[model samples]
Target: MAKTLEFAYETPQEVKVGDDETTFTLVCKNEGLPVDLTTAKLITVKIGSRDGYLREQPISIDSLSKLPTGQFKFNFDKDTLDNFPTGSYFLEVWVADDQGTSIYPSGNPLNFIVTANIENSSGATITTIAYDDFVKELNKAASTIVKGDKGDKGDKGDKGDKGDKGDTGATGIQGPKGDKGDKGDTGTTGPQGPQGATGPTGPKADKGDKGDTGTVDNAGLISAPAFHSLQTQVNNSAVGTNLITNSNFSSGLDHWKVNPGANSDCKAVVTTDSDGDTCIHITGTGDACGLYFGPVSFNQNQVTTASVLAKGIGTIWWIGLQSRPFSNFGTISTESYSKIGSIMQADSSSDTFCVYFNPVNNVVDIYIKFAKLELGSHATDWCPNSAEILTQSDYAKIKAAIVALGGSLS
Candidate 1:
């Protein structure tokens, strides 16, 4: 294919007779081309004795340094031009492709060059071209090529009728649905849907492998991709599989063992709470027994936290989660610091994270909402469990971060 390129010369208009170390550039406007550089041959530059356009090759100057820019640098050092007389000269540059066909810009008559050589015996005085002054003059000259005096302001044309939007293109193929849903409003989430019929129990709780204590992952410096890469791995792992089954309690007690525990004598009932979310209603007489759900499996030492919203129908209640208790299941944690929620982080390796309503009461009737036992030590905003492990927010974050770091989702 033919290529179009804009080229510019960085050469000054004059050179001293013995300027042995002067360097100038021929820049490529686009980086897409190889600039005639190749393993078999180099782009060449030569000087011509006469100034008219050279239909033929000119006298070759010695080979030039192929610059990193892919352009060549023609040098006129003391040795290279020792015998040449001080006079006007023209230059031509050309390169050959693998096919041996030469490629080059149209040869133009080079701009005039004033050479200070021995032939001009008049001792010379140097004139200064301040960088700023040169730039200002250059800008002024450049502006003249593309600008002219503004014509008297033309009257505004009549407003054109709004063009109908181009017909909507046929819908493109539907993309796969986003992997996760958004982490919606974050307050104490109300109860999820009332538990549906308790499904057949899972195999009797198996004594399983204790989860491993995962290494603490840290974010890397934006400058250091290693850190980012490491954190990315960690994030990916965390986002793989969700441990909580029936997180929203939508399937009733499908993955849960909502049995009344020690001294309790009530069955776990699926019902909605004031918040209008499905929840488990545990009601029976027992000083301690309550609905228990889990034997959540995990990798050894993998930290996890269990969360549930709970409140008592009676004065005192023992609401527990992941074998831990959240003192006030419905109130802001800060209001009564003593009335706490959020279980301490623990490794799921040796012990399982369980949720139970073993409140401290004789006839305990408590409502438990959204029992979530997830992999992280902290609970993020709740999103219903499904095919996606991460929430919508999490999905967006990981995708954005990966893209920013020049990565792609698999």
Candidate 2:
């Protein structure tokens, strides 16, 4: 195929030695269209000089979705840049796809400079001499010293007289404490007076008559029909909202399928939660017990959030044709229901997406409820399927409304 891959990166790409957390954001296209990065098995950025190679760093798998559309980031840590010296280097993005390996820029590679840090560049040039040369110079200096240096020991002079010794100093004493003062006298107490006489009691009053009971009006309260109407409205609103089919497993794994790779010991069953609500219980021992709901339709570059009311630890993954965005909820309480979710953006080829559930380990027991996969960056309240939300009364009300509006029904 002709050269179709094009790469563009942000500028100010200079880096300092010993620096960490350096990043390069790159946007790629193929034939003037955004390239799907998730399709590649591996993507790496190689840094090298004209002489040879320096270092190569791969993009982190988890953070790929955190970037904007058609963009990928290559992060360099302290260890990678610490080895680089002050010099100019060339970098190329290498992608390994199903077709073959390809490098970006179809022409010359991009240039990036690694400047010297203060700790590495402050000293001047240092010179070193050979050991044999130092030995030869030492021998020549030793030969120049003569044996006539022993005649200076003949002149000894007399010493001067000593002075008189000084007297010893006396010790000092601490001062005495002052005397305490006398205390003052207390005041006298006052005399007590005589008590007054008590007054006479009044007559008792009569009790009043009992009041009548108030009546309760049950007509204004929500009846079975009214409740069914409200519930139908809620479910109808959420009919086509959730991307995943049978997300809550209310139909006992009707639309979910067990992963073929999961261990044979894994088991899934319809169970009830502590609150008497329906849920799916998955359990296994010694291997991954996984299930998935797939082929969920999504728009290009659409952002979606997936959530689950769960008890016990597990990993939730939003699997797309070219991207996998996942989050682990380890702090889920076994004693009560806990909500866990993850937000991800779909790639250009993201029409096919899947919601995958994997237990933290093979030896597992988990209760799952309200499994929701919906469009938008945040999760909303959970609702049942449209078919399951309506009761017989709800259908009757809909027919009545249609009839009153002069609409015909079969």
Candidate 3:
């Protein structure tokens, strides 16, 4: 009875297992004898396999007690040591005094080792405990969180406090112009548009008013002075004695003559009346005399030589000569003259008479030649009531027989 008790034990030299919670501290030292232990029990504490050391269901150390210099404070719950098991934890502290059940005091046999002070492998709470000291503390915290020797950038931070003017923000209601945005895909075609700057020259207009003169119809009568007086008589001279001495006769008529009776040749007898129209009463003498008429003719010595045979009016005469100089004068009767063999003489003193007037068979084909200076005639009455008189002395004897057959009358 003198030795009331003797027990000794202290734990948690190092025991840590976590994920939720675990800690260890159990010290019970009582060399017994101060004896006021009325009920202290943690009677059994054994956890997993050191050859099957079971019994872990009773954890009631009751916050431990027994102190009066016996040193006992067993607080090992930590939620039951986090349901225990991270290695070597064999603790058995059975203590009881004062009649609940005898006590088995055993403490020094304690080998406290629940070592894992925040380190675990399969239950997971290892924060780089060793892998080469966690790669040298993660390379010294990544060399102070990366970015070394480049220092020059720091002076920009003092500009922020002007904030209270915000009430003017209500005017932003105009945001609706946004729908035109889709045309942007055409961008690669922009290098070709720079050539357009040349337009500024507009003001010089006032000069248009002068057009009105167009009306010409049927303007015809230009004989150009009768073709300039027939080209000045074919340039003065010899268009075959100026066409038989300018032809156009009828002044004292005659120059044709060769009449002996009824068919008297060279007779300048032209007649027309009762509207058949004509005129012929020459007296310009025998064969109609020289200024024109005579191809020659006769009738004189009337009653004594008994030559009284008168039947002389077979009319068909046209003699109009004028270029002068006719010396032969005898046997020149273009008999009855109906063309009298187509006279031609052109030179030995020019003679050309190609006549053919048939005032309805009042026949007159007298073409006599040999005209040197005078061969002009003109009685064109072509019957139908004839009245084409033209006579200013037969137009001055056909203009002096066209200037004596050497043309150029002007």
CA lDDT, every prediction?
A: 0.46, 0.56, 0.32
For model 1, the stretches where C-alpha displacement exceeds 4 angstroms are: 1-242, 314-341, 348-351, 358-361, 386-410
lDDT of candidate model 3 versus the reference: 0.32
lDDT of 3 at 305: 6
Q: How many steric clashes between backbone atoms does each model show?
A: 25, 1, 28
lDDT of 3 by residue, 264-294 (tens): 3334455432334233322222222212322
Candidate 2 Cα errors over 4 Å, as ranges = 1-240, 260-262, 286-288, 313-323, 326-330, 348-362, 385-410
In the range 1-410, model 1's lDDT, one tens digit per residue, is: 12212223224433556666765444321122445353425455555554444233321223334355444444565544544445445555555556673534332323223355644334565443455754555454444443334434434434434433333334335446887776545445344444344344334443444444333212222323343444445654763245666767888887666455555466678888666789877776553444455565545443344456656642222223343312122221212111213323344433443544333324556666665555533445565555535778888899999999999986
Clashing pairs in 2: 287-362
Per-model TM-score versus the true fold: 0.32, 0.36, 0.16
Residue 282, candidate 2: how far off, in angstroms?
0.8
Ranking by lDDT: 2, 1, 3
